[model samples]
Target: MGHPHRLGIVGLGNISAAYLDTLADSAQIRITAVADLDTARARTLADRLPHARALSVSELVASDEVDTVLNLTIPAAHAEIALAAIGHGKNVYGEKPLAARMADAREIVAAALAAGVGLGSAPDTVLGTGLQTARHAIDDGLIGRPLAASAVMVTAGHERWHPSPDFYYQSGGGPLLDMGPYYVAALVHLLGPVRSVTGAASRLRGTRTITQGPRAGAVIPVDVDTHITGVLEHDSGALSTITTSFDGAATDAAPLEVHGENGTLSVPDPNRFDGETRFFELGATQWRPLPTAAGYLDSARGIGLLDFIAAGPDRAARANGDIALHSLDVMTSLLQSAAEGRRLELTTTTERPLAVPLTAREVWSQRE
Candidate 1:
């Protein structure tokens, strides 16, 4: 615990910069190496980082200096990179959806378990104030006996601004897969685990044109559904209806809203680290913003890793792979339910992660 845990980052994409921003002042972790298929991009990050060296993916995962591999690889390659990191006997954490498929996610989990290394995943946005405050309200009984919830994410899609938006429409990419993790993770935090799901999905367009970024005017193929809606039956007797769509332009939908026996909680967007969390009592006329009463306030991307690290070897990390797998299981089942036109029972289950107390960032880093 005397030295910062050495982090080897694989995949230096747009998101990598945000993680680097969070890691800059982190006492719990430090970037020791970075890798990307774009070698020059890796070199660029290495130049800007205080002590990071540019290495090949293989080298970075195997580097003796690295204690954990912070995998930011695209969804399709998530398992390959994670399995490789675990093979090297290093702990691993990555971006959402765990992998392109549940099978790969299962493999990733199995390998990490066998290797005895820590496994964690993202949409760590749940570890932030927005979702945590809402959770605090429910746990505090401000919202009595949670009964139902809704998670909505509707947009025209990422091709509008992303330079290369090909992945968003690919087999591993879809509104449900790309954006559902945040909502699903947040829902699990609010209402335990999911037991089953029933879904319906549709696609009205076959192709899309990139409207912005360097690849403007480029046409991308659409291989997945553009619109998806589903109902989740949580084990705790709470039902959640979720809709994730790239086909819609806008909506008045709250990012998330949880209704209980006595009150309704309008949660903030789980895609971000912080925001206003609004709530309304049974007889209240209007919703009110809840104070930041739990979780890490004023935080960002890599805090998940910090939180995971803070949990130590003997404790369970809130963002651990078990929950990510459960979330992915829920999302994939939604798609399956859509195709089969029937509700699907989930094959995985996970406990609600322990709540984050209102601890200062420095204190988390200093924990044993």
Candidate 2:
């Protein structure tokens, strides 16, 4: 390898720790700089890395030592940080929902293309053994022709755990926008791009109290819907029903499932890197767990970044910008469809990303 990609991280939130943990031992990337709105937070994390230094958000984006910016900012700030990094000609990989709005997301994608910079987004979890194995099975005809899918995610609310859960209830935040990206992204990976959608939504509580962290007992206003249900029509004619909610206390529904002409696949949670992918054939009496047939083994949050950088110029990253934009469009259109009480055609679409060939942790970590 010529040299490890110099990485600058722009957010030090709860999610950042997970990425940091995953990238800590990577040989193909180096944490060169760290920045956060809270200067102290950046300094504290930077101090833990021998070669890293803390910088202001502006400085980090423009740093000569940095080649790529890992953006972990909240949904609302995604475009701002991404645009800044792209403006400085840095490759960017960020947490999901590319932007809170489709207009901003399109502008970000346009800016990156104009600047000739690489862009990627999260829920890279789909590239892990769990979802990829499912994809492999689908593609291998283990499930004949995929006809439909269903994804369900239900929880009381994030305010029960996330300290600063305000963002989860804000304009750009909600059950569908926050959690739907993972499921939608996975659906796109498994079935294909969505052509249109019909949706319905409801906000169960107007206010919620924080139950954990420093903000425990603090009440926050809810500005967006807490529950969302939708049916997606994939370009390939596969239909997927989805439900994401902060209103429900819990659910026994499987995280994801795909039905085909000859079999049914039970996919693990998209938010997780690995889990059991079960399948039931047309005449089978019991579901069987599929072997790990594809994707990164023992991977985590930052694997997508590694995959993005490794793609080089030959192909788009598995978690590239186009898919993120399409996922965003699917989600925003769902909300719009709900509000309008009608099915709406999506304005954006992307070819299903290439499936991740089964890879070991040691191999991908050292890959260029």
Count clashing residue pairs per candidate.
0, 0
The best candidate by lDDT is: 2
Q: For candidate 2, lDDT tens digit of each residue in 194-287?
A: 9999999998979999999887999999999999999999989999999999999899999999999999999999999999999999999999
Total colliding residue pairs, candidate 2: 0
Q: What lDDT does candidate 2 reach at residue 5?
A: 83
Residue 84 C-alpha lDDT in model 2: 96
lDDT of 2: 0.93
lDDT of 1 by residue, 1-368 (tens): 22688899999898988887788657677788999999999898899878899999999999999999999989999999999999999999999989989999999999999989999999889998888888888999988999999999999999987989899999889999999999999999999999999999999699999999878998889999999999999999899999999998898989999999999998888998789988888998997888899988777898898878767766799999999999999999999999999989999999898888787766654432
Q: Candidate 1: misplaced stretches above 4 Å?
A: 362-368
Error of 1 at 65 (Å): 1.1
lDDT of each: 0.90, 0.93
